[model samples]
Target: MKIVATPIQGVYLVETTPFQDERGSFYRAFCDRELDSLLQGETICQVNVSRTEAVGAIRGLHFQYPPHAEMKLIRCLKGRVWDVAVDLRQDSSTFLKCYQAELSADNAYMMVIPQGCAHGFQVLEAGSELLYLHTAYYEPKSEGGIRYSDPKLNISWPLKVTDVSTRDSSHPLLSEDFRGVVL
Candidate 1:
């Protein structure tokens, strides 16, 4: 596994090398040893998977606030997606900036999203599936989000967004006075 840093402070791109032969292909999807430093003392507390059937469905721009903030490692399992992470750390230099990567089964790539950042994805292929490893469990009271079409962020989604959950669409746009989340 190779980890590369993005402009966002704690976000990263992880590349896993897959071995292929006549039998098929095999890849080390996760290695605790390889990610020890990046994870600090945090262990994955929850694992989740989602399959989106539409070609351009969007799922999020979600995060947890303060005490419940979680770090996520996301990978594509069956198809392709345009994964994105936006820095929301109030004290970080890159706050509000976003980094996107194309994650697909063939690429064996994953995106590491740290606490105080919002995560979301747009499906690039039909039936795209994603596996997520989270450092914290879901906490309804701490859940937070920013609108996918927030004018302040102007996220340049690669595909024409064809679907967005009503919950996501209802998230309020960032206001000028919004100070962002504090870790």
Candidate 2:
């Protein structure tokens, strides 16, 4: 796997080298040694999967607060999606900056989002499945998110959002009163 740093610190776009043959193809999606080198000593503690059924479906802009913050290695397992990460680390050079990439089974690529970033995705095709290896387990009380269409962030989603969870729709916009810092 080759890791390329994004505009945001600690976030990366990882491209995997796939070996293909007439039978099919295979690639190493994750390796302890490789990730260890990239993350120093950070340990991945949980793995999660999300499956979306329709195009234009959106989820997240989500993150966990300090003490429960998670670093995520995210990839699309089936179909496609426009994956995005927003820097929320206060004092970071790229605070509030966003990075986006097309992730699909065909590309065999993954994105690494550090603890101080919020992550989200828009389904580019029906039946999209996403897999995430996280450095921390879910902590409901620590959960927080910004609205997908927050004017301050001005995320330019590729598609018109057709569906979103009520929770996501009800998320507060990023503002001075918000406790979480936008990295």
Candidate 3:
């Protein structure tokens, strides 16, 4: 696997080396040794999957606060999506900066979003499935999100948004008073 760093300090785009044969293809999705060395001991404790049934579905801009902050390894399992990560670490040099990548089953690429970043994705194809390996489980009390269409972020979404959860739609915009605290 190859890990490509993003503009944000701890974020990366991981590409797997696939071994193709007559039967099918094989690839190592994750290796504890390799990841432990790279991340210096970040431990993944949970795995989650999200299956979106419609094109243009938007599902985040989400992150958890201190004590429940999560580092995520994400990939598209069945279809395609425009995945995004926004730096929200207040003390980091790249705070507020954003990175985007196209994730599809065909490319077999995954994105690593560090604890201080907010992650989101827009489905580019119907029936897209996203798989995530996280360092922490969900904590509703510590969960927070910014609006997907926040003007300050100006995310260039690839498709016209067709659906969003009511809770996601009601997420507050990030404002000066709401600066995130770095962990």
Clashes of each: 0, 6, 0
Best by lDDT: 1
Which residue segments of model 2 deviate by more than 4 Å?
177-183
TM-score of candidate 2 against the unseen true structure: 0.95
- RMSD (Cα, Å) for all candidates, in order, is 0.7, 1.6, 1.1
lDDT tens digits, residue span 1-183, model 3: 888888889999999877998998888878878777556788888999999988999999899988999999998988999999998997789888889999998889999998889999999998999999998999999998989999889999988999999989999988877666568
TM-scores for every candidate against the unseen true structure: 0.98, 0.95, 0.96
Model 1: per-residue Cα lDDT over 1-183, one tens digit each: 999989888999999989999998999988889999889999998999999999888999999997999999999999999999999999899989999999999999999999999999999999999999999999999999999888778888989999999999999999889898988
Q: Write the residue-wise lDDT of candidate 2 on 1-183 in tens digits.
A: 898888888889999978999999999989979877667788889998999998999999899987888889999999999999988887787888899999999999999999889999999999999999998889999897988888878888999999999999999888776544543
Question: Which has the higher TM-score value, candidate number 1 or candidate number 3?
Answer: 1
Q: How close is candidate 3 to the true structure, as a TM-score?
A: 0.96
Residue 19 lDDT in model 2?
A: 98
Model 1 segments more than 4 A misplaced: none
Residue 147 CA displacement from its true place in model 3, Å: 0.6
Which candidate number has the best TM-score? 1
* Ranked candidates, highest TM-score first: 1, 3, 2
Candidates 1 and 2: which is better by lDDT?
Answer: 1
